[model samples]
Target: MNYRLLWAGAISGLALHLAGLGWDVYRHSRDVTLAQREDVLSLANPSHLMIVAGTAIMAACLLGIAVTWMNERRFGGEGAFGGLLRGAGLPAVGIAAAGSIWLASRADSSGHVHDASHSHGPQQAIVLDLPLARAVGNETAARFVASSGGHTHASAGSFGADAAMGEGSAHHHHAEVPVTAEQLEAAAAFVARLRTAIAPYEDIRRAMADGYLQITQDLPGIAAHFIRLDYRNDGREMDPERPEVLLYTKRLDGTWRLVGAMFLAEGVTEEPPSYFGPLDAWHYHENLCFVGSGVRTVASREQCPGAFTARTPWQLHVWTVPTAGGVFAHDMPEIDPGAFPGAVLPAAQELRAQAR
Candidate 1:
């Protein structure tokens, strides 16, 4: 055997294996859905194939070296240490190869089943509560009728005074206009369908199991957002059954409550869907910087160090819980920490009194 040729092949194979592994890691980091779609040992995955080829070449070269050492020993070699070392190399390589194959098989089978089960299929609808659905529908309709004619009402200064405010002191509100009876009926039907479809997700664990990943920490006024990347990018428009994001609130009792569902448009350029008529006022985030798991709005791209800035898809929230801002309100009033349900936290009552 040519030992020099064997050594060269081993080095090259190891380099190739490392390169494939690194590339796979980078790809996964960029797109998380790849883990759900790609099998660990699939021949169709170029990276997996490269890894297998590299391992095979390295194993073959090591085996050749072992054979050459043994042949030399049989002839005239006399070093005990060298003989023992060469003898151990054969089984070490064999064990490593076996381990790799076993691990890959185990991972492929388990991951494929788990991912396939949760990642696809149509959502099942649940029984709807008629009274609750009607109340939500009526509330939405009332808000629109009250705000018709494009009039802006001043926000009560006393509300949310104690809570930490965002960039602007002035509250921004969208004007709600009246809709046709047909539009109102459609909006009600949409709400009923949404309530039933999202009933299963009331339990946070079930939501997580269905691929809803939490993207933000709990806020005092607003709920945390748990986004499902697969649904967000699947090219479907305004699917109430498969919302792009779920809103959750952590109660004082250490339980998570499902507050609402958020829908997303395909892109900022795309017109927002009118699934709920004029009640659904779609909005988008701009100048937002994301790093690791955290995201925040930045003045400009230059302010985001070690992070990337991008405008998010057009989004609209549909609140299940009662909020001061109504069903389609952009912001929710801060809830009392001690309150059981959705009681609004007391704002600066002194400010209200002074205003009066």
Candidate 2:
């Protein structure tokens, strides 16, 4: 038997398999890290575990090599029995190691499939009378926001401050593909159906009861005028004609009118769509806290004790309703500063504080 060639083939297979596996893990972890730079630990911990596992796999390979060499030296490398034993043992160990690693990879992929199947979108915060920042500070307020059903709509006159805003903000971003006039006309027609079928207040109640709409957030200020809808987790696609959230404005007579809608995918990385045009921008909430009960916008997940802060999937709003920052802008027109709270950043000079 050509023992040298046999050993060469065995080692080559093992090396190639390990290298491929290592590269795959490295790429996946790198993507996760780049996407969630603020919440490094979310993926870093798992990556560390994977490193340990790879170390063990390498150690096993080395140990097998050592045992084979020792047996060859003691029993002689020329005989039929010796050759048979060495051939059987080396190939068996190499094949087993490669197969095990491949199977492990398949199992990990299955976990991701399971997660996607049970994906969740943003937490729907029901209407709250209290201030948004203060609500995050109070446990009772947090629980209420987590559980309350949306309240009555506020008057549309409250949104008059946003009416004068420019329309260019929403259409400013570039489209991924050239948006033809035909597509724009089609989108407008689809929105018209939403306007007619969905009333301001009563229809919202029916939609929620029918499981079509969910109340996501209650924008700050006296007006219960702006409530976000979570179209995600409802098996809806990020179709421009059928967005995830249908933003509504409450009229003076206490009716709700469709204003805008958000488009998004659950737990995906930076690849959010340019549904309207290239000028359209998609954003995700960073350092957001998701305790079992409520979601809080914070500087870092570390700010919330025992809370898991991870990067949220990308989402973009398209306002059919008029607003200051344009219809497709990120922030609501003339919105209260406290509507989405941010964490306080430590001073750059404070080295110890910066580590946290």
Candidate 3:
């Protein structure tokens, strides 16, 4: 008939649950704000929200044990058996807490890992221009190569002119680099393996925590909300087939679809895979300022004090989506809005606008 013990335990459990829920909400809010790109928030997705709920439940159970022990002391029921039970629960609670922490950390790292909108000083970065005339063994052929090298953002009103001129001049340089049969074979083999190894969200979820995919960054201002997959931190050597990052474009319909893959190797002397060679544009992002809302590119490492420095792996995008930028262009501003399967461009635009 000792109702005090029961009441105390119930109150403690409820309070702990509420406290944990509050903490989780605060954490998620902060994380969402720091979510690198506008579209990359963690709690915005259902999969990540579930992890937050589970943590609250575990916290309630853990605090409930503490209340039961306190009541045992108050009632002078601290016998050998009572003591044993109380002690036993502590270890179980500890194990459960550990597991919960692991799951929580996994969720955070996987979703936020790609938000490298933060900068990394160019410790290992080697910035190289694209379309370096690798295939043009003779000087005559090299003269035709468009020497623009990297992307130059246009003023707000100049997007159309910039894109048009780029297509007129740079298009041939991007596409005309003839692929040798051997190089084509190598690229095809690598793409096949990548396709087989990773899928949309499900299989990618597994690879996110494993050694496969370890970094992600949102390429803001592109036509499609594009996220770059990276592997510089995966703690393993990367091969040609295992690209530095897999590119995914978010449809206006709130679904993420695979658009391309990027291959990058560290070190200044390192060259891209034979498949990429000099045909594809390889680019890197150097110093960037990361804020709670998004990332801003800076001129130099000194420009952004205390900001993270991100030295990118040399990159080549293999666009699978029907992009205005040819299949091998680094990025495309002219993505066909209506091209995504199962999504009407107008509806997607409305929905994505609301989502933002």
Candidate 4:
């Protein structure tokens, strides 16, 4: 058989795979859209499609080299000893060295998978009626003392349950909540401050801390519109603590909308100190995807259709507010601000304040 065709195909495939992977890395390294970057990254990893192509190419190259050596020695007076000597010859060694280096580099280029422990997104606020915040705060405290179990969704929404069919009733009864300039500034500044505070470790559990952001209409007897936080606890060092350690609660305002998010990491009390903060949203566990039929959370044992597990070891979640129909099926971006427009910088000056 002609080893020439095999060698040509192998070299061409190798080049193609390397080029594709290289472009992916370059695109991710620079600032880009979240969807585009992630899509590119998924294709470039060692265990991805590109890597499979490279592996096939490398195998073909080895086969070609072996056949070439055998054919050469057979046609001439050379034998096994001669072929072995030829294999270690200067040209062969140099080719082997080059291929080894390329494969090694490709493997190392992947590094660790991306996740919450590696991000610094925005920290937008979800301002609600003060009464709702207090109500959630109060109910969260009460539930902890009463049940001795932790809560994830606030006093308004339930994590595991679907929004009730009355969800569409808001169209007739309530008006659309308009976004305000002042509220926009507040959201921007909130994210700016958080992105600065959790500079180095902003991507992990610390990022999930204090995640509740309220988007309220600020009306009495109405749902305040709370966005819940959810996170997956996989490949992490979360300590298995006492069941009495955390308190979470959700309330009903006779409406299906969320009112507020409240978490109690420490002890129960009347206006006493709580360990968990609502800087982010408080969810039992966020579904990385909710567009499909099933839901998922931390270390979810099952895969949902239409949901892609990130090419990363991540802390993932989903945010929910009562929607016009059944529920909001939006893919809420990860709550880190560093990648947002006019985001805040994580500086040394901010470090001192957090330390103190």
Candidate 5:
């Protein structure tokens, strides 16, 4: 048996193991969400496979070395007890192999748990006329209070339910009384002022020049969001002239059209103001994971990378363009690429129906 060959194989396997470990670390740091979502710790991961292969090769090489040494000792007139002691290497290898298999099984089981915990279900929207404080049952409110570490709010019960149900659901209470004609007139007047203020942003270049940077790509049924970070935290709540974000959609001809404006409250803890009286229903996002140039809702805090689980500030959308959800809808409707500039887009419900 050539001991030199075994030593060389052992060193090569160690090198591969080290390289794989380093690669795994780098991937986790740079792409944490993707790595976790893809379960990079599993055997299917290239780095994990390399590590396993390297360990197997190194173990085989060591076993071969041990066997060769035992053979040499046995043929050289070694005592039976000495030969038996040397043969312990075989059992040692077997034990190590069993331990490795056990660890691998544990890892696979954990991967299954991770996948189950991160699974997302379809979102359901529930509308209520009563405030969240009164809408939820006493038991639900108690549970919410316990989960929130004794924090209490009129809307906390509803928010807790929303968190459990996952994202894409808006829970807001309409005023008990119907919106009066005067309130509608005032809202229309506010909308007129807002439209005039953002009229210059019809050209997307002007919006970009005015510190509105695009935050999201074009969503299939939703317009892209462009935000001015400074305006978001300026302590201005529902300033028509200084909206926190602008909504835009790309036309079929490649031109960008202004669609709507989003008004954000100054803080997450602050109660959402009814700018348009009962017509405006503000909503916030919780457990949203934000990676570079992307944001998504996760089922659990563990799924959110970088510990970005802070609830978003309450926000309301006011569409200047025609939409089925009206001017002050929580969500924007689907825009038609081939439609004229002032054309009304299909309602969000209509789009969902068409998709189904």
Candidate 6:
């Protein structure tokens, strides 16, 4: 019996399983929540392990063939049957060993599943404390939106007030025109146009590569591959802060066609869904920045607008990313949840086309 094949099969399986195990241990020691764990599992596709099992079984069979190949010439001998049994034994053992290792890899914190995290891609993320995020909640988000809209580090007086009232203060008021039914109708129309634009595109992958790319060509300096997109909307909310439910890519269509209006904000936040997903899951609050009378810099985050222009209302944005890069929740923040719940869709669709 060639033990080399037996050990080789076992070792390969063990290494992969251990890498997964490490990530799992990290999540549990840190208390990754139920919601976070669920999303991670989706990437794992525990069911996908069944595929792994098939490959492992085949590998074991192949080893048996290798060993049996050595014994094929002994076919006429009485020991041939013994040789066959011995040849098949190592691989079978290897397969069983691999299965056990893989099973022990993903351990549900509650002690249900065998693993904790799933494989999405390379992730080097730092998860900020959720409590800190809650501490900054709507106030931070609202300010971020305003700053991105060109309300920079100016005093409350600069925007018209005399006192330096904190952001979104009771005294800080906006002459926000009432959302007229006509404006709402127009928003609805935009959503309808978007649905039509995307529906013919088959799926999210193609749409992100082509459709979104074509529409945003008017905007400059975007790498189709360097970005990813996702969208969500949970209908009207009395407060608009509390989450109602989650969105699904499988059942996404016409229903998302009912957007009202989109608001641009300043800070890049640490929200989910839009703020995260795969490798390119970073959300930047995109607001129109003004340089005197000129407006530019529609795309590309790190790049500044221009040298000759004054970037006053510089579309300030705060980016939110997962603690572990691709490790973000499904119910993450939608780009423009209130307006139409479809802000990220268009951009993502453009990239999806490029991929195709």
Against the reference, the lDDT scores of all candidates come to: 0.58, 0.40, 0.42, 0.32, 0.56, 0.31
Off by over 4 Å in 4: 30-48, 71-318, 321-356
lDDT of 1 at 246: 88
| Per-residue accuracy of model 2 over 1-356 as CA lDDT, tens digit each | 34465456556656655665576576556433122112222222354344435545554556566565657585545778776776576668767866765555444211010010112222112212344313122322211111011111222222211223357764332112344544344334444444444444244454345444322232321112222344465566555434555554332222343445666665566456444333344555556554432345666556766455466566655544433333334444332222222112111212235457
Q: After superposition, how far is residue 273 of candidate 3 from its true place, in Å?
A: 6.0
**Which is the winner by TM-score between candidate 1 and candidate 2?**
1
Better of 2 and 6 by lDDT: 2
Give TM-scores for every candidate, taking all chains together and pairing residue i with residue i.
0.47, 0.35, 0.39, 0.26, 0.44, 0.24
Number of clashes found in candidate 3: 9
* Weakest ten-residue segment in model 3 by summed lDDT: 119-128
Ordering by lDDT: 1, 5, 3, 2, 4, 6
Worst 10-residue lDDT window for candidate 6 reads: 217-226
What range of 10 consecutive residues in model 2 has the weakest lDDT sum? 109-118
**Which candidate leads the pack in TM-score?**
1
User: Tell me, what's the RMSD of every candidate?
Assistant: 21.6, 21.5, 20.4, 19.7, 16.2, 18.2
What are the per-residue Cα lDDT tens digits for candidate 5 across 1-356? Answer: 89999999988888888888898788667543333234324665687777877877787788888788878767435777676667775878768895875576455221211111121122222233223313222222211111111111222113223233325985554223344555555665676678889999987668777898765544423456788988978867788889999887653233467878888888765455665445565666666675544456687778877436557776666777654334554434334212312112222322345579
Q: What's the TM for model 5? A: 0.44
Q: Please state the error at residue 297 of candidate 6 in Å.
A: 13
Model 4 accuracy (lDDT, Cα)? 0.32
Scored by lDDT, model 2 comes in at 0.40
